[model samples]
Target: MPRIPFVIPLLLSLLGLAACSPPPTLDQQLYIWQRQWRPAHVEALAQTRLDFSTLRVLALQAHPKAGWARAYPDLQLLKRDGRPLVAVVRLDGQLPQLDPRAIGEQITSLLHDWQAAGIQLAGLEIDHDCATARLPAYAALLQDLRRQLPAELKLSITALPAWLASDQLEPLLASVDSSVLQVHAVSDPRRGLFDAEQAQHWAAEYAARSPSPFLLALPAYGVALLDSPAGAPRVEGEAPLRQGGTRRELQADPQHVASLLAELRDDPPPGLSGIIWFRLPLAGDRRAWPIDTLLAVVRGQPLRPALDLHAQQNGQLSELQLVNRGNLASALPAHIELPAQGCTAADGLGAYRVTSTPQGLRFTRQHPGQLAAGSQRALGWARCTQIDQGGLHVEL
Candidate 1:
């Protein structure tokens, strides 16, 4: 009979729960790195029709021990026209002699120079993989840049997963506008670069911890791992295919990334800005996915292999061509069924295993090979005693 004083408090609590809002969704963007720009790269990107709203470009990097920095100078190679750009200056090597004042001045100068050149600077991103012990120095450098940069411009940093657990992380994030959690490259490649389960766990943990909006940077490029006869892997190289020694290339499957995207979309992190790809795909880069495939995955679309079959005949000689028209790589068929028999191989298709199938001759690669997107490979030419003039009817 105390006038039911707790009733109003209970009703207010329910109201607060009802009025709470869900976390906001993050925008998806692409990173243009790990490839030299060419006409094909430009054309491939154009064909995809992806809305690359922001292009994060690697512009400059600080020299070790010296306060001076070097500009990429050939920024034109990026071909990042008609998009807001985020100029990233990477700090590499030891920073024992790092001078915050000198480094800040260099960065501020670079920003002003790019601005004068009519480049739209959405923000300046500092990519420094600083150690836990170096947090104070990193924080000081960021604070100085914050004071020096124009108020209209923003500041960001590329953060390591290990750094997320550091006590200095919160204070560091406070000094900048945003940060990028590079979820990939957490470990050595031979051990594997990305772990989907680990990524999801980190996302949930970091979302609850980060105070400012940040991005989840996923891997888009691949590395070629070469192993010796002794079974030791050599993980460093710039070329696509390494000669001498067993070489195996590793790339992230777009479909897998799509699954991760779906999980995040259902419930994204509280402070997440969006997802950013580590590198954009190039038309000539066989190790990377086609732009269309990457775009599809990002948009949560289904991916499947698309092959175009073509038949050609010249007199008694006939040819069969299988073209990969889709944006994802696929395995070659184990055998091709010919509508009629009495056909023999006229031209050997390099190294292959030719075996007899009930329907026709089965063709399998002696060595493992994949059909790359947008590429045409010869299935082999055959001389038919009785050829279908219209063309050889075949099944893949």
Candidate 2:
């Protein structure tokens, strides 16, 4: 028998047509980075109450070191969704050595492939965090891409906060149909990354000087920085992120986004087309904001934090449960004390040294960790020497 070959669906992109509906007079769009191929994204889009005219999907990544491009493995387009989709190709590796011709060829090939899949694209986007000094080279690459693509295809780029200060900004913005100002990232987590006031200032300043309409890209995901005793927060390393010791460098909650939007709405920036979330929130992402939170924020509603604690007992073991019922993360209690007396270490709680405190028997997190939003964690079990109808009482 002949060996069988693996087969997967190709991405279908329809460029030059962006709006999901009959009318193209929409203002805002959503960007979806393809982390995996799951029908849940399209389902989420269909189910979401948020109003978005288009969806910008990550299609390819161009690497300068290898001088090659790689297409996303999991992304597959569906013919039925009415929303328009724009393919976004992220350029990575060394900034200066990026070959415009090579990148353009990759884009051209992707355009053909997606076109064959019957995907109607509204435009194409280039996402690159270029260095200030390398703006000229980046501009040159965009120009080449522009020439390579059809005249009807709108071109866009993702801009950085630092780029607004550079003299190259004007020329750079002039080269594309529009630019997305990413306001969510932090250069130093220890100094606090997301500042609404600072972001407002940047948006106003850039919008005033922008030659074309721009999209303000805000973060929907959270960042975890390694907290050091040396008073510096470092980026995640090769090792797995250890909970409890890490700090929430930035909290991109609905309330914060609403505040920013409210401020921006008061005096809308010049040349500001609309807002583009850094990502479309998914259920599996531990750090991504909940869909409810995203929709509420879009609708200018308030957010909340809900933390619930429950107790259960089995034989000599007593269990304490912590559940985050809200859309935002809840800080784990520094220590939890139970109402029972004469409680000693048992089960996994023994590792944390379950001991008697002044109030009662306490279990402390050996390392501090944030309980994820809409997640449940068992605080472990304590073998209390005594029990009563009063039940397990946990004091934070």
Candidate 3:
């Protein structure tokens, strides 16, 4: 055989090295922030087991006026999965001061209660939105909490991007085993929920300052901003607010976030351990991405929207439903038409209105709405002697 040229052999060696290099390791976790447990959590927890290795649950919240309120999470459901859990204690940003010892005692008591209930706790995460000026004081509090926590339990903090501006941030992070830098809803509500570029910049800066490994908390949910007479817009999250005004909905796009994840995975920042998704999506959660959509983003799969019309028939009655059969959430179609003859009655349901047409019944969208991935909604009902299922039409 002819001897290989020097450049060819060198190129082959480089390719071989590249092929042998293992991809970066990034752990995925979830935040369960519901104040009260629901029956839906059982299914949500089961679906997330394979993709998410840990769960950071909101266990206690401390408010200025209300004092402390423990979250009513279903302990049995949480413990059944056997995934490592992190109890998140939220201290209201308006809190005037910090009594490290007292707060530490409260956390320890809650930990004991959870342990007795058979929860496999791996850590405690302090979620406090203290001002940048308070970093030194916050660091001191973490130090005290660290000393108080059980040796096996890791201590972490939900760090703010604003903290990057403070010189004391390094010390604050030093007090904990790790930190989670929240990159969503940190700016003006009018600007929207998440900015991929801004998030990447924050991650890079955080990775530089953090002495220990840290995770990035990204949004998997949406919120409505209702204009109020007050200076600030009222935010509607999982629950609706009594106040009414022109609503502007903001959601973090799954494709945008998926692209960001790809960038991070390709060139991961130092001390960046993983991603922790904000609030796991639950059934009947109007403001969250469908669980399937979130999973697709996590797995770096393509996002595709598939919306179709399905008619369920029983005798002369037909239930018209819009089904989203893709891994991406889709906006409701503007109009849906079903060809029919000798129709006795037809009416739209939900965000649609029906009108009788020459050839069929037209279902026009009355209000804007989203049909989550892998979900179906009843569009309307029609009772006709001759309804054509094959003639169904939809305008997106």
Candidate 4:
């Protein structure tokens, strides 16, 4: 008996199943760009261990004037967990020319030194913001560097979206094992730091152009643009520069980024491997997102801001505090009212204005402020004969 009919139905069913199957999970990595590693990195690394599979650390940076500066990262901290690590070497875009052999030699020497220090490196990444016209030369540099590197170690490059228009893009990509397409802060600073729509478009375009596997470098942090009289605004990230003209702060919204991530996960571009966050946020890093907030977004968990008011009483004195208990950071409430009677003294702290009313004490916000997740802020203190915690009112 002929079995063609049965085989056709079976093949159709298999195709249907394949079509409905979920896309592959995108791996998440992090860039530890901090040149100086501190004790706080210990906690930061531990917190992100489950989410980030690899670490792309800044090992060395070449400056136009200062020449070359090596990062003093804590080797013990990075090697403790045995995670796959990639050493990144940055070449300033302002440089006039690059000696391919000299640069390659320096990188090779750096790799040897790191290996001697017992640091296991999985790959090497060259971060050079070369102009589109100079891509051919950039490719030559990468090719030379690749030859100098050990055959076992993978070589990658941080690619720019502007290079898409150049005919040399394909060859530039071909010179490396992988590429990291940076989608944040690639546009005019006056416009903003990140545009989700534009980023998605770039990612799709990059996937079409890149033959090798690639990752999207999304921003998990923010920057302050200090106005300069001379030219472009000076960007301040991680630390503040010398005081300048009016300042504007730009931050990447977690909700927007999470939505984008969900869209990509549902239907990822071809050859798109994963995401490498621009930075791993530390406790002291003010411009970056809170660790909890970043983790929640990466895990696709719901983001909810929870603010709680606490009044610690010692005799007649009460210390008022506001605590953010949820995974999302929240703005400080605009008004806080505490019903009280026979209050001898009451005062507001920080950006709040205190008003002692006949019925209670009212604290009105004088300025805007954000309370980070798992952080608490002191509001004010009050001394009253009768105060009701149940009647505490807050207006956000």
Please report the candidate that would top TM-score against the real structure: 4
Residue-by-residue lDDT tens digits, candidate 4, 286-372: 889889999999999999888877889998899988889898888889998879988998888998878998769999999998898
**Ten consecutive residues with minimal summed lDDT in candidate 3?**
238-247
Computed on alpha carbons, the lDDT of every model, listed in order, comes to: 0.71, 0.71, 0.91, 0.90
lDDT of 1 by residue, 1-396 (tens): 467678899999988986686555558777765423456656655654455567787777765655455545334433355666788888874655567777777777887777666676788888887777788778887898788888988999988778767888888888998999888866667877677778888877777777898899987666777875666676643464445766667777666777888888777767777898877666667656667677777777788777665568786677867677787777766554444367665443754455554455555656556777678788767676653333333233
lDDT of 2 by residue, 1-396 (tens): 965443322222233233232432216577777545565676677755347777788888866555455555233444466577788888873545787767777888998988877776789999888788999988888887888889999999988888877899999988999988888764566665477788888898898778998888877667668767777765542234664584555566556678988767656777787888767777676567777677666766666656675568787677866777776566676666556666666443422446666545666767666766667788666677664424434343
User: Distance from true position, residue 288, model 2, in Å?
Assistant: 2.5
Q: Each prediction's TM-score against the native?
A: 0.81, 0.75, 0.91, 0.96
Model 3 misplacement above 4 A: 1-22, 342-344, 355-359
Model 4 worst lDDT run, 10 consecutive residues: 238-247
Clashes of each: 0, 9, 0, 0
TM-score, candidate number 4: 0.96
lDDT score for candidate 3 against the true structure: 0.91
Q: Measured by TM-score, how close is model 3 to the native structure?
A: 0.91
Clashing pairs in 1: none
Candidate 4 residue-wise lDDT at 365: 95
Which wins on lDDT, candidate 1 or candidate 3? 3
- Candidate 1 has an lDDT of 0.71
